[model samples]
Target: MRRLRQLAERTPAGRERYVDLLRALAIVMVVLGHWGITVIGYDRAGRPTGHSALGDLPWAWPLTWVAQVMPVFFLVGGYANAASLTARRSRGGDATGWLIDRSARLVRPTTALLVVLVVGAAVAHLRGADPTEIRTVVWFATIPLWFLVAYLVVVPLTPPMYALHRRFGLVVPLVLVGLVALGDLGRILGPAGLATGNYLFGWLAVHQLGFAWYDARSPTNPPRRRLPTSRRTGAVLLAVGLVVLVLLTVVGPYPVAMLNVPGARLDNAAPPSLALLAVATAQLGLILLLQAPARRWLRRSGPWQAVIAVNSVVLTVFLWHLTAAVLLIGLLDALGVLPTPRVGSAAWWAWRVPWLLALAVVLAALVAVFGPIEARTRRHGDTTARGRRRTALAVAGYAGVVAGLLLNSLTRKAAPEPLGLPTPALLAYLAGAGVLRLLRSGWGSRG
Candidate 1:
């Protein structure tokens, strides 16, 4: 805490401290929302299972608009990624090197989670745990991977997509919106899975908007950028976003909930509908509207320190919080202490208070366990190799990691389920890493 305070005090001048605050806020909301909604139950034979409260509480649909914070992360990612790319290029860093730097932080931590999940599943299988129970647990644990996989699909595109952002400005996101509209149309029409394409287009739109936010205060923009101008822009965005949202949900084919409710035919969140993009626009506007004052508030050492503390372990918290929740569910169930009040009952709401507290403690312990691995994933000063070989290795390596995540997630499937420890995905990922290591080693030639 003391060190973070000192670090906060030494924060570089002209830094956009509010971005960190927004990210931290988003992480908090995600953790709290997930923990609160997650409810675990046991089958008649004592097998554990899990589900969301959103399924039972139809009245709570509108509340999800504020809770669905994924767009905020992408928004911040855009600003931060843009800043990083600009800075790296300024320092003579190419896209290949930049990709390597970015991938290390994300992939290393993700690898740790996958390794642990595979090992845990293996141990359960060796002990003769029921296949149904194991699959349920694995599915619950890998929920975070859904977002992670989607983000991975987009992360590699930062360089090229960012180039489009620079070349076309706001037109990039506008085009993405058109793409999302097309996707939404396909989703609503015959083949619903066609909307899955929006996972990239939708998030890319929010991310591209982040670039717009960054551009407002960019070095290229006027230094004397007036507050009223940005605020006016924000207001227009807010108005347009709300109008579109109403049209999509009320007048069009989307659902009211911003989240992907279980078993819903039209999931606004899973593939991300235009309605969700509407929500993102509103959230982005709210972010822009609040940025100036938020930065001013973040000037306080106390608030800034908290933001730093959370951001430091943000990935760890996100990765393991659900795991912690799952463990607690089993433990509390065994001890006959896990609450099972009716879904929307007053007693159920009462149980959430203690349930969340317990989950937080477990999550804190998990973060403490895994946070150091994340801390150690820092950028080395080693220069990357340049050439076609370098680009090929980096791209292949990144694709391997993504394939590995997707394959590991497949273990969560029913019917022809994987027995344990997703070996193929693990090998694929290892092979990818080997190629990346070869890339780093200059492809058997000196850099």
Candidate 2:
């Protein structure tokens, strides 16, 4: 028992490597998952005609295991939120302002992107493009934005929901798991059932897991504290999580989609599923087990520091990734450079990989364009020059987004269509970038 306690309470070396590695790893999963859907065309489709051999290969679901790293994102988010709230309270900062700033950090960038997309689609229609085609293009271009809406819904609720964490401890996640099962069962049996409501409770449950991890509060259970030993608890968590995952996959209606396919009946990802909860548990255990090794690795790796440096702009990367793909595709098609989005054959997959790589490069370049705006707003600390400079840049970037949105609207003057990559999108990019920058600077400064 004493040995078990030591293992459980033993602190991983270095500062927050598990969290950072998890975040980076989660983001990588997200990118790869997206790459599969858009570039790889992998996964089973509802219809036989929808199958793509190259994309939906035998290894797809296993790949989804890596791709569904979203649960970890929420876990990290919970940890960060708890840390942020604690830090802010310590400094006597207004809770309202802290939340407002956080909300703005998400909203500002997100709004800009939406405005651009909505406006750009409208313009493409005005230019005499087919309405369905325009809509299809825009929809594909901005699919990942759904996370923004979901995150926002959960972020505001964190203050209150976190209380449940204090009371329930790790049991909160189990309760959430129960809720998902209930929700799924209801949807399966009832007439008016859809899993939409599950989105609120189910995903929030995942997010709350992070809060528990955060609020566990002690670095290591004190040697004198009579809590269950770390080794025993970890082993228990690992065993149970593995068992649950196997059981759920075998018996559950869940489809193991870490990424959305064009036509899926029940998206395990759209609202998430109990399967995801199990995956998260297994992942959390792994993270805990390897904390020491991850820390040592991060310390030794310089490139990792670069990744950490850039993670502040995670939303930026996530939001614009689709646009980058669309832009590359649009340009290639225009120049007779790239083929249409047809899924089949190794040849198609091979060609698409380079295009996806090019898409990533373009996204990086595009993100760089907004780097200045992102930098200004995300600055921390009290300084007149920094504040003034950030405020000015923020305002200008916001204005650019607005201007772009307005221009996109006007560009659609004669005929109406949804906005596309027209002027509105450009404005949205600037606006979103500027707003996130401001918040990053403001929030970071306070910390």
Candidate 3:
């Protein structure tokens, strides 16, 4: 607490603390929302079995309007990336080296988590636990990796994406939206898997909104230019978003749920749709309207310190929270203390109280254990430009890391009876981590 206060006090006066606040808030919501909707019970074999409540209960769909908060994260991502890239360029670093630096921060901590999970998988298999069941839990445990994969995809594009943002302004996102709609149409009418392109388009559009916020908060942007987050604009966004959201989900084909519900025909999030973008607009509006007050509140020492503390290891908390929850669930199930109530019943809702509490306790412990790994990864300066051979290694390193993360993000339906990542993908990820570590070192760069 004392260290956090000192760190908070030392913050640059010009820093946009609210963006940090929004990021911390988004992670909290994602964790809690996942905990609440998780439907769980011990099977007849006394093994744990569960899935998203959105699968078992339709009424829970409306809660997604509040629970789905990734848009805010991406928006904040855009703003932060814009700031970071600006700072990097100001320091004379190229995008590739800067990207390598960025990738290491995320990838290093991720490597720790994957190592633990892989070990756990092997242990379970050795203990005669069903490989299929072990893989099921592993898949759930690694769900957060998909977002990491998606974020990694965009992080490298930040330089170019910010370029487009600076040159074209709002038109960039408008065009991206057109692409998102096209992707959605392809999903419906074209060949299978074509619409997956929106995974990048839809999120990139939201990230672009952050670029707008970066400019929105900048004093250098001309005052004569229309402010992106003005109250009037927020109102318009909120109104249009609500109307379009209703039209798409109610009158149009998209499902009401914002997140992917298992067994659903279409997921607004998996391959984001027009509906998800509408949600982003409304979310962005509320973010705009709330921006000032949020900044004001965050200015206080106590609040700013808290946000700082969370942001310091937010990735660790995110990476390990589900694993912690699943572990606790298993423990409680083995102890015969875990409850199994009817889905959507009053008791089930009440059960979330203890469930969340237990998960929190476990998650806090796990964070304490794993967060230092992330802290050690906190980088300040960007990597200097390296030669051609180094660039090739960096490219291969990044490709392998993202590819491995994506491979592990598969569902049972996608890779039937999957029992952990394929050996080659795991090897790629491990080899990639080794290569990246070498690139980070001056000694390795010389050769």
Candidate 4:
């Protein structure tokens, strides 16, 4: 614990290389996981429709364990919140305003991206594609959008959550572990009632653990003085996390790898498991231990500046990358050049390599067109006339979204249901409106 405090104390301010490196790692893993999914086919219900274990690769499950799922993303997010909130406090920013600002950044990009996808889905349906098939594709494509909703919910709670960190620290993770264990025991050993509710709470409990870590590490003063003891504490926490993970897998009913089996009714990932919680703790602990090394390396690298420059665009990429993938696949198919979509075949999986490459090309193209527009839009908080107009526009936009979601729920399908997407679209629209309102106010106040 003392060593841990010393390491953290040595970390320079506004120079969070460890966190940034962890962020890049999380993003790259997420993208790779998504790219892998494109190769694996899905049925009209959005279940995995193919398997790749036939390649006889023994490393398959282990690879999935390392690459798939969203735990790492949430872990890094907690770190960012801690750093950002601490920085904001030093600058005298109000908690409500900070929440509002962060929420706007998250919501608007998602809204812009989802509107494009929904419009595209409508067009595909009109063109006589199987409604169920297209609906399933859209359902599958919207998986990444959940991060926006989850982050918004988690970020605003940071103020209180940070308080929990100060009080409980390591005990926080223990309590979460207990909750997850009880949830798992109920589902796997007993009547299995309310598994869905348990699932939501269970996964969110893991996200809160990240918040706790941030609180422990973040302080208004120099970090070392506040942190109990950095190096020894970090190592012990990491070791404990690993032991818990091994025990859960050995004694529990769940598989360690997160991705669902083809045709499996329930997925470990959709409502993540204790295994994931274990993985997150271990990952977070290790990252904390390596903070000093990461900071030193990042300080020396000029390329990191470029990554930090675009750090704000991570949400934009996650929201729209799937759309870019869909566009690339459709374009190639229309030209009669790309192979047709298939299920349960090695050759089909093989074609995904090139499709992923094309997905990259398409994402770059979208960024080229919309990136500047998004950048300029965020700066709108500087003037009053434009602020008032933008606020009005945002209100109207949110009203439209409410109407659309209600209609979809009544007439089309239940969102957040079996292979559905209600949370992302709804949350995105709300967040976008909030962003517009803020920017308008910022602009008006400046004037």
Candidate 5:
């Protein structure tokens, strides 16, 4: 802890603490939101059953607009990636090298989660656990990996996208938003296939805006030509986004909930809608409006150090949070100590405080054990034959991870047996990790 404080104090003068602060807050909100909405219970036969609380509490829909922080996550990702890429370029690094470095940070922590899930599933199957139950558990546990899959795709595209941002400024995101609108329209009137495009377009749009923000505040830019960096600009963003959000939900086909509500006729989030983009716009505005004060507050050692520590294990916390919730709840259930309340009842709401605390404790323990995998820095080999091969191996490694997660998501319930894990996905993930390990070892050659 003391070391983290010292590290924070040494932060570069040009570094924006507020960006890290936003990322930490966004991750916390997501974890808490997932914990709150997930309602797990045991059936009469003591089998576990679960669903999101949002299914029963329709009125809580509006709360999702605030709780859904994916946009902010992507926005911050853009800012951080832009800064990172720029710094790497200044040092004469190529896009491939920059990508390898960034991807390592995400994939390392993710590999730990995937490996654990595979082992746990195999162990449960060996113990004569119901395949159906095992499948459900594994699927639910891996839900958080969806973000990793999306983010991995976006990270590799950052170099080219940042270049586009430089040439066209805010037009990139604007065009992306326009595409999101078209995707939504297609979902309404055309083949359902077009809706899937939003999965990329929506997030890419928000990410592009982050580049805009970075360029707007670039220290080298002349003051006169810089984009308006005032509170007024943020206010305009807030107003326009809010107005569009209301219109989309109230007057258009979109739902007010920013998240995908079970059995909802139109999900604003499954394939992000223009409405979701509007929410993101409003969120970016709100974040900008508070940036000045947030930056000032973050200058203090205590607050900034906390942010640094959280950011250090951000991926670990996200990847393991659901597992922590499941472990805690499953243990309590097995012991007959788990509380089951009606989804929206006062009792259920009251239990949330303790539920969150218990989950946090479990998550913390998981982090303590697994977080170091993410923090451990790998040695970069010289840019020789070995280094190029290492880069190729790294790309294959990330590809395997991305493919495995994507396949897992797509085929989650495709199997007839409950206990069946996606064999192909598991193999791909393991193979990728193995290749990365070999590369890290310099392909069996001495360092």
Candidate 6:
């Protein structure tokens, strides 16, 4: 703790401390929201089943607009990526190098989770666990990887998108918003396939705004710069987004919830409707408005240190949070202490505080065991033939991880099979991690 405080005290003078704070806060909110809404119960056969509390309480949909922090996550990702790309380029680094380095950070920590799940699932299956129960458990654990898959795609595209931002500025996000609207319309009037494009376009648009935010404060581009950090700009964004969101829900085909409801005919989030984009706009606006104050508050040593500690383990917390919830709930159930309150009932609401606390304890333990993997950094091998080959191998490894997660998201099934996990995704991820490890060990020796 003392070391962390000293580290915070040594933070670079001009760093955007607020970006880290926002990212950490977004992760916390996402974890809490997931823990709160996930209602686990037992079937007549005494197997665990889970559903979201929001499905039962439509009135709570409005709350999700605030709780859905994914926009902020991407926005911060854009800001950080722009800064990273700029720094790397100034040092004569190429996009491939930057992509490999950035992707390694995500892929490494993810490999830890995947290994545990794969081995644990195999053991459970061998022990004669119900296949349906195993499937449910594995599916719940891997569901959060969707964000990782999407963000992985967005990260590699940052180089090109940053270039586009440099050329067209705000027009990029505007066009993306237009595309989101078109996708929503296509979903309404045509096949739902058109809306799938928005899954990328919508997030890319939000990410583009991050580039805009970075450009607004660019040290190089003075004449073209526009300060989105200004309060008035934020007010305009908030007002416009809120109005559009209300109209989308009231008059358009979009649902009010920023998340998917189990049986909803139209989900704002599944394909990410313009309504969700509006919510993101409002969130970005609110975050920008709070940026100045947040920066000021973060100037203090204590708060900044907390943010630093959290950011250091952010990925660990995110990847293990759901697993923690599952394990904690399962333990409590086995001990006959877990409550099976009706979803959205008063008793369920009362249970949320304790449930979150217990989940946090479990997550903290998971982090203690696995957090070092996230913090470990290895020196790059020499860039000769051996080095280049290893780098390529590392990149392939990261790609496999992304592909596996994407497949899992699309299939929505990550169960344990007798020989392996349900989908080929886990195999891809494992293969990728293995190649990277082999390169790390053998690349320098070959040189």
Determine which window of 10 residues in candidate 1 has minimal summed lDDT.
220-229
Candidate 2 lDDT tens digits, 1-447: 343334334534534655766776677667655655554221353111112232355457556655677778888888878767767667665444455456455655566566676777667767887764565566555566566556656776676777667665667667777777777776667542556667777778778877766656565633222123255565676677778877766566655554554455566666677777777777677666666666677665454554455565677777787777778767765676565346556666666677667977998886786543433444132331234454444444445544544444344322333454454455565564565456455533332
Candidate lDDT scores, in order, read 0.79, 0.60, 0.82, 0.58, 0.82, 0.81
| Tens digits of lDDT, candidate 4, 1-447 | 353345445656756566566666677667756766554444586333333342333346445656654676776677677677777667665444455455456656656765666666667767765666565556545656555545555665677776676666646556766776676666677656635554445545655655655555556633322433377767986898778877766575666555655554345665566777766666667766887776677665354554453454666667667667666656665675656455445776777678677778888788776565455444212223333454444444444444434333333432322223344545645554655455536532332
**Counting only residues 3 or more apart in sequence or on different chains, how many pairs clash (N, Cα, C under 3 Å) in candidate 4?**
17
How far residue 165's Cα lies from its native spot in candidate 2, in Å, is: 1.9
Task: In candidate 1, list every pair of residues with a backbone clash.
Answer: none
Q: How well is each residue in 1-447 modelled by candidate 6, as lDDT tens digits?
A: 988978887899989999999999999999999988988788888766778888898889999999988999999999899988888778776665666667657878888887788788779878987665676677788778888888887887888888888887888888998988888888989877888888889899989888877877765774333336788888888999999999988787788899878988887876678899999989877887888889999999989999999998899999999999889878988888879899877898898899888889999999999998886654353332334655567568667777877776666343445423455877887776676565544442242
Each candidate's number of clashing pairs is 0, 26, 0, 17, 4, 0
- Please report the TM-score between candidate 2 and the true structure: 0.74
- Give per-residue CA lDDT, model 5, range 1-447, as digits (tens): 879978987899989899999999999999999998989887677777777888888899989889999999999999899988888778776665676666567778887887787788778888987777777788888888778788887887898898888777777778888888888888889877888889888899989877777777767864332345579988998899999999989898888898878888788877888999999988878887998999999989999999999998998999999999889978998888889888888999899999999999999999999999887755363342335555567678778878888888887552533334588887887787677666544463222
A best-first ranking of the candidates according to their lDDT comes to 3, 5, 6, 1, 2, 4
lDDT of the structure predicted as candidate 6: 0.81
Ranking by TM-score: 3, 1, 5, 6, 2, 4
- When summed lDDT is taken over every stretch of 10 residues in candidate 4, the lowest stretch is 379-388
Q: What is the C-alpha RMSD of each candidate to the true structure, in Å?
A: 2.6, 9.3, 2.3, 7.6, 2.7, 2.6
Looking at model 6, report the run of 10 residues with the lowest lDDT sum.
378-387
Q: CA lDDT of 95 in candidate 6?
A: 61
After aligning candidate 4 to the native by TM-score, how far in Å is the CA of 121 from where it should be? 3.2
TM-score against truth, every candidate: 0.93, 0.74, 0.94, 0.74, 0.93, 0.93
On a 0 to 100 scale, what is the lDDT of residue 366 in model 6? Answer: 99
TM-score, predicted candidate 3 vs. hidden true structure: 0.94
lDDT of 5: 0.82
Candidate 6 local Cα displacement, residue 117, angstroms: 0.6
Candidate 2's C-alpha runs over 4 A off are 1-15, 39-55, 122-126, 192-194, 217-236, 261-264, 301-304, 340-344, 379-417, 420-447
Q: Name the candidate that leads on lDDT.
A: 3
Clashing pairs in 3: none
Residues 117-170, model 1: lDDT tens digits:
777877887888776667667777777878888788787798898788777777
- Candidate 4 or 1, higher lDDT: 1
TM-score for candidate 6: 0.93
